[model samples]
Target: DAGITQSPRHKVTETGTPVTLRCHQTENHRYMYWYRQDPGHGLRLIHYSYGVKDTDKGEVSDGYSVSRSKTEDFLLTLESATSSQTSVYFCAISLRVFDTEAFFGQGTRLTVV
Candidate 1:
């Protein structure tokens, strides 16, 4: 297996609440990413980490934040949940940022009313 798992597979929250999702991996890949899937947005990258304590914001990182303190864990947080932010979030791990196969977690489905 790719050794990727996500916590809180499903969540429902009121608008303006804070939500945090967790991703854990045992593969120890160098690159880890957070992605959000929606009807129109497709799969958009929210954030990614290259190494421990090394991370960067992605195209749709406006209301989201991510952190990586070790090789096996990545955390994603929505500062204030909103209906617009409701989507299926995924965690992926890859040996390279591009041109390589990436392993993805099952996904977390979140809905904000």
Candidate 2:
């Protein structure tokens, strides 16, 4: 199984503040992804990087950005947090083909008020 972990498993923040969440992987996978899981919405991709310095926005990329400077680390940043952004964020790593299942971290619970 792939090894992946996320930092700041739980966080609470005020509106208009900036927050960063970190993801680290030991599997040396070629693809990394950040997603948010909300009730009734399933998991929506926030951002993903195929390779170092090569990232692209996902369906819900607004109010969020990501960076992957090294193969082992990926970071997600919220420039200005908001209540609507409060949700559980997950990090995943995939080296397998598209049909194969990816591995996910425990997740980070973020709450904004």
Candidate 3:
């Protein structure tokens, strides 16, 4: 989401628990994306939505799910968290048609035990 960063900037959870992260935007951007950051990987896309109910999986979509029911909100869900899923997550908003750079959230750090 634009302006606001990912919620719960830091979290730790046990393995196998369901986790939901939220992103909200004030600017009605057309494109929203979820991504994970890991050492050596920089950032890997998890999922993206161009409009409400219109979503597509990204490069690292496995074990993760996303939903966007409103223009200002996008959600990422981890059905069963694993150690491999412990990473910094980011939400980004883009205009798509314009040349402007995407606006990124501050990021959320999720640690699974």
Candidate 4:
């Protein structure tokens, strides 16, 4: 286990609303990532922060954003929720090699109506 947790294990929201998901870690890992897992598309990265104040967009970052001002916390926000964004979200942390296996939080199931 990588000592990671995600809040609101499940969420339901209307379209056009704003939502934020939180990721917390206890190991003080240097890398944290937010990814969305869809049925056929697999797990796609939304954003990642390598360190405090050091963040970058990932492959599927268009409708999402992230921030990390501390080593143990990373936040993901959906500016405006959309039905297209309904998916299971997962947070991961990396502490070993670059391709090191990541540990995932239980996941947050988001549904936008």
Candidate 5:
């Protein structure tokens, strides 16, 4: 089972506004990630945290930021919402840091208008 949960299953925000999405995990995994799923891009990584306060940018990290204050929680923030940022965001947890296995949350759908 996916032990990860994403808050605010759906959201509609205006462009230029700051938006934050939350991912909570109960699996106590050491690695957590934020990914955006688009029609053609599939799932593109936005950011990932290996531990508390330890985060690194991913392929599409521009205009985005992430924070991990606790092992159970990871947050992704869009500094300024943009039409291009509208997509389904997913949270993933892994038992291994190198992508051995991952469990994904239901996903949060965000629309920028």
Candidate 6:
């Protein structure tokens, strides 16, 4: 949590509005990820970046988009937020060459009304 930084750690917004969340890392890792936590689904990946300017969508990429313009920064955007989009968003970073565990940020709790 200390290594990774998330801006606007908590947020409240109206439906149909656009919102953006930021994640900053100091580890200089090559991989960064964005995820959302919900009750039944556990933790679902929203998007990820392998390197600067290289990003990919994850399983739950429908309403979310991501960008990584710098090695230590990743951003997740909600184009048009809805009530159903309210959830806790987390950012993770990993330096592993293969399959391994990743470090995560504290998380950003977002609520839409």
- lDDT (CA) for every model shown? 0.94, 0.95, 0.92, 0.93, 0.94, 0.93
Q: Once superposed on the true structure, which residue ranges of model 6 sit more than 4 Å away at CA?
A: none
lDDT of 1 by residue, 39-103 (tens): 87789999999999999998899999988989999999999999999899999999886799999
Model 4 worst lDDT window (10 residues): 94-103
Off by over 4 Å in 5: none
Model 3 ranges with Cα > 4 A deviation: none
TM-score of each: 0.95, 0.96, 0.94, 0.95, 0.96, 0.94
RMSD of each: 1.0, 1.0, 1.6, 1.0, 1.0, 1.2
Instruction: Identify the superior model by lDDT, candidate 3 or candidate 6.
Output: 6
lDDT tens per residue, model 2, 1-113: 56898999999999999999999999989899999999999999999999999999999999998999999999999999999999999999988648777899999999999
Model 6 residue 82 CA deviation in Å: 1.0
Shift in Å, residue 48, candidate 5: 0.5
What is the alpha-carbon lDDT for the whole of candidate 1? Answer: 0.94
Residue-level lDDT tens digits of model 3 in 16-41:
99999999988888899999999999
Candidate 3 total steric clashes: 0
C-alpha lDDT (0 to 100) for residue 12 of candidate 6: 100
Q: How many backbone clashes does candidate 4 have?
A: 0
